[model samples]
Target: MIQVLRPARFTELTGEDEDIPRPPLSQTRTAQQSRRRKQKKQLERRWRHSAVVAALTPAQAAAVATTHADATSALDLLTFLSRERSHEYSPDTFATLALRLVEARRCPADVGRARVHMIRACRTPLEMTRAMDDLDTLARRGPRMDLMAYGALLVQLNTLGMIDVTRARQLRQASTVHPPILVFLATGLVGSQVRWGSGAPLPQGIDLFFLSHPILSTLASSDRLLPRSPAHARHLFDGMPRRKKRQSAPPVSIADRIGTLPDSLLHHVLSFLPVQAVVRTCVLARRWRHLWRSTTSLRIVGLDDNYYVDVEELRKFVDHFLILRERTDLDLVEIKFNEFCEEDQPYVKTWVRFALMCKVRRLTFHVRGSQYLYLDPHLVSRHLRTLDLDGVGLPETFLDFGSCPVLEDLKISHCIINACRILSHSLKHLSIYCCHNEFNCRIHVSTPCLVSLKLDHFIGRTPLLENMALLESADVYLSDYCKDVCLNYDSGVLCGSNNNACQNCVPIEDDCSRECVLLGGISNAKYLKLLPGSKTFVFTRDLKHCPTFIKLKTLLLNEYWCEAPDLDPLACILKNSPVLEKLTLQLFSEGPNHKVEIKGRYSSMERPSAISEHLNIVEVKCSVVDERILKVLKFLSALNICFIF
Candidate 1:
């Protein structure tokens, strides 16, 4: 409550006393009215103080301290409480108010008024010392002075230096608290100590000490007793820029820090590190020993030292890790094992089943061995989105991913395709690389949603394709070895003398049937990259039954062998693809003697009358284009197509 000050008692309001002379009778009436007004205002302030004290709960005060834009008001409230209701505020309460006030700029009057409250908040010496220490630490870390103040200090130093017209002008500037000036002073002191020593003569009745030492001394004095050192001079060097090295922070265990975080957050952090590193965290402290069981993502890569060194140990660890996972849902489960023992097969199957049981979304396996690893069909999960299998063959029935509904991307590399059919409804991307077709393997696929398909170094009878209406792009490369059977065929003069042997010769119907099925499936592809590995068989094998690529826009022919007959397949593809826009010929030949001759645009058959309006760009990637290649270029130029070689 605000105490009304009497005329003679100044301390009642302002905390001071002053005597006032009494007014005459004429002024007495006005003085009486003024005293009554003061009393009424004091009474109103007392009631308001009571109401404010009742409303200002601890939570409300903290809220105001955090959200209030006017910090001066908060400081004033605390100051008023300190004066009227001093017992209500604790050390923590005042400390919080003081911090808020320090964080924002307050008026000089408000700061002075709050100073008393801040003092009262820390009633004990220890509390005040702790508060001061915290403030000092904050000040050391925060900016010593703002840019504006720094600029003003520089200006002051410049003005002071102008008074001295000697080299000592810099020394005069160094006496200021400017950081650069202080650095210069410290450097000068070091140099002085290195150059001068005790051999130097000493002056009478004068004392000196090293600037680095916290010692006080006088330059010279002849007073009755001993001379006193100047306080200002002693403090002048206190602003040296050399910061005292801070003590190293105390050692903190990883488990202690991790234990402080929520279990979910700790699991997420562990997920990014390798499984080995995650397991190693158990040694940090007792709290982290069981934390690995909470991780949701598991990536077991066998190529690393932590994985395949001991297959048995790795198997046991994985089994334990999976069994301990309390959560039912997992984000990713990846297992990449280059090689493992036959005896470890059961453990691998168990690991996969466990992952399926947990409803893992993405699964990958790279386990390789002599025989194909048979996976249980019942272990499939519908939540799977991506399934990548490398160096691991699949069973004939496992190719169809009906059990995995949401599977969108599939990859098979260096594996045997014993399956007769590969079908999926939700698949968008499919890649098969270096895959061998088993004996009697009749590969087929009917993925209507497939958008991108890549086939490289594929060996086998062509897979039957159906319902691939949405197929947009395809990269097909038949291996050179696959065409060895077709190359051995004797077409013109086939051993007429040995008529009986001629009957046993290879039949073309089987090869043509495979080509027909494969080409029919990818007929709607918009972009096709056909890398032919054989010079003659590729054209003779498939060109007869090649389907129309009405939507074909881009065609790439990677010709590694520049044989004269290699152009036949490319010519067939170009003639059939009417809408093809960009033609790229990737040529790689070692011999300069090799040359290609294109007598005409294509075979002697009459050229199609329909001019390809979209066929505008022709690109040839080869170092040397001989006369034969020039003839082909000239023919393309006649059609007004641009050539970029």
Candidate 2:
């Protein structure tokens, strides 16, 4: 015992002292270890329990968990168990999870994850059907279900290629759901199959199944659902009451249903029909007698061979429409009168006066027959925002647009305007087409708010822009008489032809000779157009009087003679336009053989060295490319320029 225990191998230490002391375990430590093991086992069991419960009936627990704390704890337990173990969950449970996830605040990410899980869980058609049925149930329970979820389930069914249409019809019949939702589901299913290019034929007896659903039956009765055949139509109507059966019958003619619709829908439907059909419908019933008068739009054409409306009858129709229009407070009106006679001028004036009094927003007066149109200045509507007149003769004083203060758009086509003076402050858009008279064609526009102006004339002087501070766009196609028309600016005169040439040309006092003086040039316009004609305009140093057009971006020189004289006038413009971005020159090289030579008399005049820096792009459209034109290209290219033909 006194000797220390010698360190020895087991074989060598046979029968040696085995006297090693062992420490006893502490009670507190053993108790703590036992408690921790018990806690871990309990946690694991609770997690497994939650997973099984969630897999079986997620919706039941979801309905119970109203508080945020309860929902979060339940979700956390479910998530832990799902990650720890893989298990088969019921389709109803998955659907419930999808619904709960969607309803959670700020849970789009969770909802997306749940949707993927649910979609993956749908291995069989029955599972998919059950999921859809659960969603349908939830939709009926006052909870707002997502339309896209229904769409997804339908897509799954479609992918299977052969859906149990009978079962679907049965579910549709049993469920208390909206018809639109059911239609959406059905159409979505059909559409998805169509997308996959599948030949999945619709099931038989589907009609009978649909007929069992009240909503489907109602929709079928209303003719919203497709009828399989004429016989199907009869079958769909057979079960309806007599009153509903009569209501479901198709209308024989447009007149038959005109009075049945509410006024708003009736007017909308009538708006699509032609004026003759509208008139015929009006004669169908007493309810439709004054309905046309309340229409915001009206069109009457002489093409109808059956109706022979004389000037008096036309006047009476307009009077009746206007009287009813006043009673109903209609805003928009369009009248196309094909019957025009000298006797109808007073009647026309009366109608125009009534329209003005009613403050019609849109008024279109298209006179077909030959007649002298007299528009009294006092009768012109102040509230007329748009005025379009075509195919009539207007008085020389007709274009005195002083009364139309609120006029925003004005279009006159194939009509005569004796004096083209526009003095409206609110005039924004103006267009004149195919007017072949220039007796007093002096345009005096004082609109500070003018935005767009188009003038297409065969005989007239180019109108002057006296006060166009807000003028943004202008297109002018001048006739021979407008060759030397002058444009007066606040700063200087923009003469189209040489001022000295005007002295040699006949004076303005001579009616016939006054047309010879050509005036050109528009200053400070954003868009400018120069059209081709039988007019020779020379641009000398006086051409510098043209406006600088600091904001000019688009310039079009259309159908111009290719002579050097015409090109010389344009040089001054090209030099002055510093901010010009797009320049389009269209030349009519081949025309009536009025051989004119462009000697470039102003060739000796120095070209602006800074022009190449200012102009960015130039486009020339000509019938033939010649050497002189090549020289122009060379000149532009010499300045490191790019040209397009």
Candidate 3:
């Protein structure tokens, strides 16, 4: 919707620190083409971004305003999306740029349509044509359009003319915050919509056409502007600002009974909606016409968002929903494509081989960038069980999960790793977020009947979690770049804690780390989190070969495991967790709060057999609830351990 912004040079006109020194490094190509044609005609005759594009938005000042009476005399809205003629937004340029960013009280930018005029995020049918008033003649004057707001600029505001806006543009909503919720939300109109809970404020000149849109942005400047009586809406409903919590007294209308369910329970509730709302629920009838081809979940959200687009009718409705659905057996097929290039990789490998030839069983493929999906070496998934991926990349013949025999849950986010062993033996819940191992070796993860392991934020070489002894919940996060962390510390390399005077990490062999088995493959986990790091040393150099978790019970640690001033990796995981029970400890999370000096609180004479038999509960969030929280309550004898914070 931009109509002009020309800058072929002159450093693309306006600001972004480009160090001001280019006339192609000047050595006289005719004095650098006459000093770049006299600084491109003095920045095109001293530029004029019409008050910096209306001070950044009003739909970029109606895209360089061609004096809009509903725009479009386009003298080049920045080449209307450069280089190739793709300016195709018509429905009268999207209702004329949504009627000039919905007629003025500015909106358009980053919209979830401004949460339909926020009153603690209002919801429901409420879209009265993005409001400007005269709501279909005040919904035929019954309950005076009940505080007009079935949302969209308070519903239709008289097709954007705003019933002839008078002198409004002054000191507009100075310091926003509105919704003295239009006279206590009432009903009367449902088609253009209006079940919004009310509070008041529209006492006519139509309240200057609801202070010119963007959901009544705090209607100020009043001199009793118009509506002479009705006690100026009970004086803006006793000046509402949560006038007794939106003061509603009429919302009982529940008889829809899920439409007396049938059509296989409404095709199992339109198979948890999405493929464009289950093909717009076949216009909601004729038994939802084959109920979105026997909906067993196909959730396709082509997420390309910028605003007002088409994606070639979602690539011709996903090539006509892969030649019109009904090829049975799906249970889940989520797809999120955002421009997926390489000429759409053979139509996204024929839509992931038609969701693994319909024996789908949970598959979410999120793409946009870093795309790569070369599977099928042994992927004959016998009705696979959950495989979520994002960003993308995966090759070593899809990591020898030996033909997915009922593959058991795998999630990978922000991926890229081209395999070096993700050996799953009928995997059981594995999640790896922010993935990266393109190859710097050490990426082994033999999921030997794993049960819930989530390695978050990984980078290169620190995967190695070989055993999993039937783990039960692990959420590891090891990033201080993580190539076995201790990253070149004094270029030495023997990380046996801060005083082998701890050199960088990795090559320590018998003191463990032959690829430091990521916490000895979750040490038969019973819930662990091990999250934080500001240059982690893989669980403090795997505390020399510390493995007696003995089915640990809920530990969460951070301040990177008592980071070094000798707490001894939180006293070697509280003397190797002998039935530890809930011990949170996030520790000064967002820095600057000192006193970590618990100094083994007078040298631990007694107390660790999980703080004397089964550590009870210890919580601690912290940022500064200081005395270092009473020296971590005498350094973890935590006052008979129920010291939550």
Candidate 4:
């Protein structure tokens, strides 16, 4: 049912063809010559990349020229150069170029017809095969592709989904000894799920765990990588050097490969993993199985005891773990047990002795139990620099640390202090929290090198200090128990560790005050933070009896329950600290039970007589500014001090 219509003659048709004259040959030849000249000029201009070539050294330049002739991609150019020019170009330069190519999708830097030809000819598999054949033909005329060249080719083919088992295996063989190259191939094969156990067997001497992601993840998760934006592969590549080629020697055995690493290096590598993860490396080979024994840093902490059906098995693991370690010096040994019976004490103490014999530098012990476990003071290492203990009992000779000669930091929390005197010449930092003193045991510090001290919720007679001239900072916090004791004025007097306070202590304002003992010890502190349990206990007539703070520069009264009776004590400290530079007053908040608003202004006031010439900053932290706060601000402003609320 189709119909066609044709015109009888061209002259008769509505649109007729008329003869048009052709241009002269002379003019056409001139136009063709002009176009040819422009094309030749552009081609000549692109024959050299001055800027890119200027930055390359002789070896790198040679590698660049080789890759330029072998491949048609900016990505492939850098990939081959990274391997061939590794000795000339730093790993960072290779990493940077590789990262740049990947990020920019490998668009060529060449500005000519060849850049467009490369883009069209190498993006697909069929076209790339022809290009590779051309490269192979050229390679045969010159030098064979190196291992790095093979790795680059494999990476490109695998990324384009054109790689097969046989080809990949062949490529892996060329780069078998180079772990960095192997890792690169492995990452490319990740999405493809290629396995060497299947079709084509991996070449001999290759690691059986070539496909594993653990080492890859470890290298990738380092601080120099991922969180820093995932392009910093230089650090990961820095550790990988070119493998030695020994064609005549026997095949590399497991013992000859991983065993060749230095003991220090193996130990350092193992330190990044926990004991359990470290133990798993033993299964890799016989040589690696025992390498965990040389690891100097050990951290044994977890709830495995509670999770396991048999706790004895966990204990056996811990014991075996300690027994297998070498007796070399240790950098750190931290053991925390959630709960242990009394029977486990001897076993634990034996392990402690083992660690001490190894000269542990940092030791942390945490044991949770009902009965207070006593730690033998003699087991402490003489080289111990830092010690932390929780939920334990200190022996009578705990402070007599003749063994720990270099101990610099000590932290004791929720423990019983049986020692009355803490004497050490090397101790610099001390912290005690929620500790109770035994009867007849009043804590005393005799460390001349102590620089920082923090005492929180300590129940004992005020601590005594001697030769603390170097103390730079001190923070003291009294517990709620002190508040209860102060409120119970009818109790007569505060009892000391010796029940003999009847003669040694004096009664002040219906309660016994040991403010002198506490204040007298920290007179040399440049920065002091004090949190009294109750206002009446410290804000007494004895406040004026304390010595002058010639070294005090900054004073912080935290959680101060400001009241009408607190001004005298505040003035007392200000009067004593003549050179105080900064004062911070943080008001206390009371819950529903003690909701007494501090709003009333003092009827009469007497400011500190000391000249606060150096007191330039006064900061008041509170929710609401009451009349009492305004009065204090007015008094401080009279001395030209800056107020910050």
How high is each candidate's TM-score?
0.52, 0.49, 0.27, 0.52
lDDT for model 2, on a 0 to 1 scale?
0.53
Instruction: Answer with 1 or 2, whichever has the higher lDDT.
Output: 1
lDDT by residue for model 3 (160-266), tens: 33434422421121112122333132211211222112335443334454444432322232323222344444464455566355665585577556666766677
lDDT of 2 by residue, 1-645 (tens): 122222232112111122322123444656645654554455455546553343433333333222222232334334444566445455545556656655554234344444444544687777666655665544433233334544454456556542455355344323433345765444433332332123445444443454454444454444335344445534644766675444554755645554678888877777665455666676766788867755655554433534435566566555444432323333555556556667677767766655665567787777665554656644366678898888766665566667777889988887765665656778788787876454654455556677887877745544555556666787877655544543331112223334544432334553323321112223546887757453423223234355466778878774442344335456666677777777766655443332332211111124445452545556665566677566565654544455433
Write the residue-wise lDDT of candidate 4 on 1-645 in tens digits: 222222222112111123322233556666745654564344333323334423445454434433331122333333333444442332223333333333333322321122222323255676556545543332323223334455555455555666553354343233222344445654444323233333544433222334332344453334443222123333556667889996775765545665688888888787666577778888876679777866888766553524322224346677657644545589888776656677777767766776786788998887665667788865456799999999888888877876788999999998888877888888999998888887443466788888999988877654556557889999988765533234333222233323443333334432224445467778899999887665234433246467788999988884443443335566677778888877877665433233333321112126544545677566665566677667666665554554433
Once fitted onto the true fold, the runs of candidate 2 whose alpha carbons sit more than 4 angstroms away are 1-262, 272-276, 282-290, 303-326, 393-398, 436-441, 481-522, 534-544, 559-562, 589-608, 612-614
* Top-scoring candidate (lDDT): 4
Better of 1 and 2 by TM-score: 1
Model 1 stretches astray by more than 4 angstroms = 1-269, 282-291, 303-310, 368-372, 377-379, 483-485, 489-515, 535-539, 560-568, 589-611, 642-645
Kindly provide the TM-score of model 2 when superposed on the true structure, using C-alpha atoms. 0.49
Task: Sort the candidates on lDDT, descending order.
Answer: 4, 1, 3, 2
lDDT of 1 at 348: 83
| Number of backbone collisions per candidate | 1, 10, 24, 1
